[model samples]
Target chain A: MSAADTILFVAAWLGLALLVAAFLLTVWRVVRGPTLPDRVVALDMLVGIVIGFIALIAIRTGFTLYIDIAIALGLVGFLATVAFARFILASKGRQGAGVYSAGAPLQDTAPAPDATHVAARGARGKSAAKSAKVAARTSGKTSAKKSPKSLPASPAVAELASVPAASPAIAPGKAAEEKPSAKSIGKPANKSASKTVSKSTSKTRSKSAEKTAGKAVTKPGKPAKGE
Target chain B: MDVVFAIFTAILILGGAAFALVAAIGLNRFPDVYSRMHAASKAGTVGSGLLLLAVGVHSGELSVLARALAGFFFFVLTAPVSAHLLAIAALKAGYSMSDKTVTNEME
Candidate 1:
């Protein structure tokens, strides 16, 4: 082989090794990433690594067409990242016991089972994330109360709304009075209430029960009319 | 002439690969998504762009080099825009910063 051929060959092999290393590292991040954005970032890096692979292959094979493929992949990757960002934005209000909820924090919001999973995860430093966590806590604190009035646009919040309304501890006499109104909320409301019941049963059973009960008896009697 | 082109392509390939490796290391080690984006968008783009140039140079044809250069520039332009949008979405969605974070002017 010519001197130029030898040098090019060596560089291509070395570059391939580096690119492969990068691919594995990025994949590890994707697997271990705690939040949606982390995974998105990793996936974006993965795309870049693949583009590198394409370049290496193009150089090794002497086919310039592969360059076109790399460009197409870049376009697609950018679009995918944008779409994922939009998805993250849309999922903002889905806070109750959701594993994917961004800014849920490692210590407080995430339950014990997912603790290890979330512990090592990092969100970019911003007060906005802190504010989100605070907002979630505050919302969750009043979720039981707000769900009734708002009827909670999402079923997850609706489940939270039903927690207290479904409790038997509420005076049967009052519940009887509210039963007719509760029935009007219909099957979807009942389904969500059952979900909260099951969820609460697994977690802080007595507290969520009583907390909702104390609040449910008041004005919530109308909106939280549980099935 | 062939030797000159080969030497240049080898250098581009080596530099590009090194940058890509650095980006991967940063991505794995960075404390948060935004920092990781910093690594991926800037270093990763340069790495990939360099590799694209390598392909263009290896072909030793002006037309092929032009196509590779165009792709390289495209990477340079789009990476930042996508990263910015993603960062905003993450912030707006309330993705928290790491505990080690010392300052947040945007807060």
Candidate 2:
């Protein structure tokens, strides 16, 4: 081979080795990342390393088209990162707390009460109430500080409180009968309350009651009833 | 002239590969995500830019050079923005830096 050809061949091999190493390291980060955002960041870096590899391949093969692939990857990679970020943000908003820590347990991230959880809680009577009580106790200090006006104004909490505390003794059949009408009444209130909460407390807790409400909402399902 | 160009291309390509290897090492060794991102974004961009420049030099075609230049510019522009966004997302997700990291931002 000519001198230039030899140089080009050696450079290509070196570049390939470096790119492969980068790719593997990025993959390790993606696998080992403690948090969702960390994984996202690692994924983003992986895309970048892929782009670099594409550029190297284009140079080695003298295929101009591959450069276009690198350009498209750059654009699409940015969009992917943004989309992942949005997903995490939406989940955070739904969970109502900073439960995104990598080391934290999954149970800690119990999401806020949505319609599904509300329905489920209604279906499971005594167990749900016990869980709610547990949640209420854990979150009691925060709830105690919240003003009654704010407390009742939040439709989800209001609907929850409006449920006759005595209903725990009532059979599920009768409780179901009463819950439908109450949920219907709560539907409009739920929307306005969610909007206000989302607006006011986009980041940190505006009031601890919201966190308590989230816990209470999710609590009713599977808390080892005898415990 | 051809020999000189070939020598220059060899140096650029080799140097770029070395920088990339360093970047990969830094990514693996860095103590925190923020610092790893710092290494990946800055060194990775420069390394890629140099490799593109080498490719442009080796090709000597106006079209290929133009394409390489475009690729370099696009890489430079987007790499930093993505890094910054990732850092912001990490912070928003409540990721604390290593305790050894000396910054008063949290305080």
Q: Give model 1's docking category.
A: acceptable
| Candidate maximizing lDDT | 1
Docking class of 2: incorrect
Best by DockQ: 1
Write one digit per residue (lDDT tens) for candidate 2, span B1-107. Answer: 77677778778777776677677677778877788888778887787777777777778888888987898898789888888877776555445465567654654
Model 1 lDDT tens row, A1-227: 99999999999999999999988898988877755688898898888889999999999999899999999999999899889888877754231123211111211332332221111121222432232233322234333233232222234534534644533323323322333233132112122233432332223222222223333223223322342
Q: What are the per-model numbers of colliding residue pairs?
A: 2, 0
TM-score of each: 0.62, 0.59
**Clash pairs (backbone) in predicted model 2:** none
Residue lDDT tens for model 1, B1-107:
89999999999999999999999999999988889999999999999999999999999889999999999999999999889988988777656666577777974
- Candidate maximizing TM-score: 1
